[model samples]
Target: METKARLVAAAREPLWERGYAATSPRAVLDATGAGQGSMYHHFRGKEDLARAAVDLNTDEMRAQVDTDLGGPGPALDRLHRYLRRERDVLRGCRFGGLAQDPEAMASPVLAPRVEEMFRWPVGRLAPVVREAQAACELRPGLDADRLAVAIAAGVQGGYVLARATRDPTVFDSAVDGIVALLDTARTEP
Candidate 1:
């Protein structure tokens, strides 16, 4: 890995563990074994470094979601595959965890990037939901966008509930519950 990439990887856990507010530039440097001058040359500062990290995380997330949402299936199946995809259930959502920090939430640069990560998944799922409704796979009253947001929130909520309980089962249950709701049977005459 390049020095910058190494720096980003080293920073990921600390930022996820300590959050942007508690995390320091020096911590990233120490974690990566990069000198201050080198780190600065690669990034403007901590905020710039954080933006890079968020971008990396977001891209990875988008790719994983695409794998689930872009695959062949009914809408409910696609959404189920997405919700039930293997996850570090105990660790929580990377971007969501960061956004919970007061400093990260306040950061103009970091906040938007973190928020965008969540928004991307919701947006991607909305189209799939609309298609499902068009195919009559979903109830007539289903709101595609709202349902997408709710699904996103359920995943976020799963992370929170899991982390709070320090167990993975809570997260799994949350995911299953969301999937079950999405899989609700359509009314057939």
Candidate 2:
């Protein structure tokens, strides 16, 4: 890999694993076997480099969501596929974990990236929820945007619950519970 790419690749796992506050410049440099000068040459500093890493991770996440949400099915099925997709539940979400970091959350420079990362799922799912409503798979009274936000919130909240309990099944149960509630909205006589 190119030096800049290598640096970013090295930094991503540590940032995800340790969160922004705990991930240090030296650890990132050590991961890439690059020196301080090399990192500085490519990035303004640790936070700048972290921004790039988070951006990279967000791109990957978008691709994964597209795979699940864009799959062939009724809109609800696609949304279910998204909610049921494999995840490292106890590891928590990288963006969510980063947002939890006081250092990242406190900074205007960093918080927006974390915020935007979360906004993607809600935005992407809104149309799918609307389609389901139009098909009467969802009740007509349901607000598409709010339902989309709820779905995204469930996934993120699942991670938090699983992490807190140190139990992956807690994540599964939360997801299954949300899906069950969505099922209740199905329009049928």
Candidate that scores best on lDDT: 2
Residue pairs in candidate 2 whose N, alpha carbon or C atoms collide under 3 angstroms: none
Worst-scoring 10-residue span by lDDT in model 2? 104-113
**Candidate 2, residue 96: lDDT:** 84
Which digits, one per residue and each the tens of the lDDT, describe model 2 over residues 1-189? 888999899888878888888988898788789989999999999889988898899899999999998889898899899999999999999888898899998877789989998998899999999998888788989988999899999999999999999999999999998899899998995
Q: Whole-model Cα lDDT per candidate?
A: 0.86, 0.90
Tens digits of per-residue lDDT, candidate 1, 56-163, equal 888888889999999998876787889889999777788877878989989999988887887888899999888878778888688889999999999999999999
Q: Number of backbone collisions per candidate, in order?
A: 0, 0
Q: How many backbone clashes does candidate 2 have?
A: 0
